[model samples]
Target: MTAEHYFSAEPATPDQRGEIAFNVAGRDYRMTVASGVFSAGRLDPGTAVLLRKGDLPDAGTAGTFLDLGCGYGPIACVLASEAPRAVVHAVDVNSRARELTALNAEALGLAGRVRVAAPGEVPDDVSFDQIWSNPPTHVGKAELRALMERWLPRLAPGGVAWLVINRHLGGDSLHAWLVERGWQVERIASQKGFRVLRVAGKTD
Candidate 1:
């Protein structure tokens, strides 16, 4: 079997596609999944926990949001659906993941609100009111820290970031690391061995 990383710029695996159905916030989602993307088989467990435990926006919420490392658009779609007035940027390193997110957003009539893009494609001037992520911890500590360092500073003033990490995957250490870097980190929930962290900029 070929070892494939979901963060690969281009997955060498054949695009064997399928569908996954999940429910979040009383709404059901059916999205396209394929080989080479993260959690192509189902809604990822950490992601599922994040959605269930994190404070999701409502229909009246209005602002720019970021779905960092969006796999097949589950978090992106949910954000767009829950916050009708918000614009969601779904970003991923994998081209295949971006394609699937676009496809799913279009299928759900959220194409106008959900902007799918590669990490670098997001404009540097854009800032997020809220950032949601189930980061690629498999990428190693340095790479993961780099990813957070690259994006966390882009949070708008008073903005918050929601993240879910597997406990065994350095979740506690990550919380400590973020605090050490001056961000206020809170472990909001722990379920199924996953830690749901709510992070925000420190106030003066």
Candidate 2:
């Protein structure tokens, strides 16, 4: 049997499903999870820190948001709940993960606002006002860079992307690389060996 990887386009592992509960910004959430997805066991620590420290959109916020690499729609659910006026695009490579996200979004009554899709399925005309992710750094540097390269450019003018990466996994270096590439990167928070980066599109 092929040992399933979170990045697998099709996770061959038998679905071992689970549920994880968390509270963000005083809102409670219980979401479905399954094997062969990133951080399927719990709310990942880096994602926790990113949600805790990163700026979230408000109820009045009206714009498009992207939850890049959404595994089971936790961030997408939160964004849809908090910003009812906004639309959320949840993108992932794993089909199983996308399925779980769709289920979770419907369960949370957020299916109307949360659009779950494979990375390639999102419409090319859709641009994000804010992007949120705890990227899959285990995918290796070159692939990781390529993932970011493809999505980050879809940020609208003045858009911001919030990312949390393990410090041991080249967090600082990635921040530096963004700077070198003309992204205005800010180290918003550092905790539990993870760095939260706030990257703004460079305005000419």
Candidate 3:
């Protein structure tokens, strides 16, 4: 049997389901999680730091947003809740993760606004006003770079992306790489060994 990673397209592990609760931006969230997904036991530290340190949309915020690599929809749900007028596209490679994200969005009454899908399922015509991610660094540098290359270009003009990366896991190098790619990247916050980066298209 092949080993299962959280990035597995279809995890072979048993779906031992549970719930995780956390608060972000003064709002409490309880989400359903299962085995074979990323951070099935709790909110991931990088994700928590991203939500805490990154700038979140307010109620008045309106636009299409992407929560790339959404694991059970914590970031997607929060974005939908915070910006009721906005739509959040929660994309993940893991089928179980997509299922859990859909379930949690429905539970939180955010099913209408949170669009959970596999990476390929998002429409080609859609572009995002904002993108948020605590990307999977364990995927190796090449795969990680490919992920960015695949998605970062989907940002609408004037759009911004928020990302949190562990310092020990090439966070600084990623920032440098983005700059080299002609994107404007700034380290907006650093806490608990994670760096929150604000990235935007370069203006010349």
Number of the predicted model whose TM-score against the real structure is largest? 1
Residue-level error in angstroms, candidate 1, position 90? 0.4
Clashing residue pairs for model 3:
none
Per-residue lDDT tens digits for candidate 1, residues 83-193, read 999999999989999999999999999999999999989999999999999999988899999999999999999999999999999899999999999999999999999
* Candidate 2: clashing residue pairs, number: 0
Any runs in candidate 1 off by more than 4 Å, and if so which? 1-3
| Model 1 lDDT at residue 69 | 95
Give me candidate 2's TM-score against the actual structure: 0.96
Report the C-alpha displacement of residue 9, candidate 3, in angstroms: 0.5
lDDT per model vs. reference: 0.95, 0.91, 0.93
The true-versus-predicted C-alpha distance at residue 136 of model 2, in Å, is: 0.5
Model 2 lDDT per residue over 50-169, tens place: 999999999899999999999888888888999999999999999998999999999989898999998878999999999999888888889888888999999999899999999999
lDDT of 3 by residue, 1-204 (tens): 222468899888888899889999999999889889998889999999999988999999999999999988999999999999999999999999999999999999999999999999999999999999999998888888999999999999999999999999999999999999999999999999999999998655
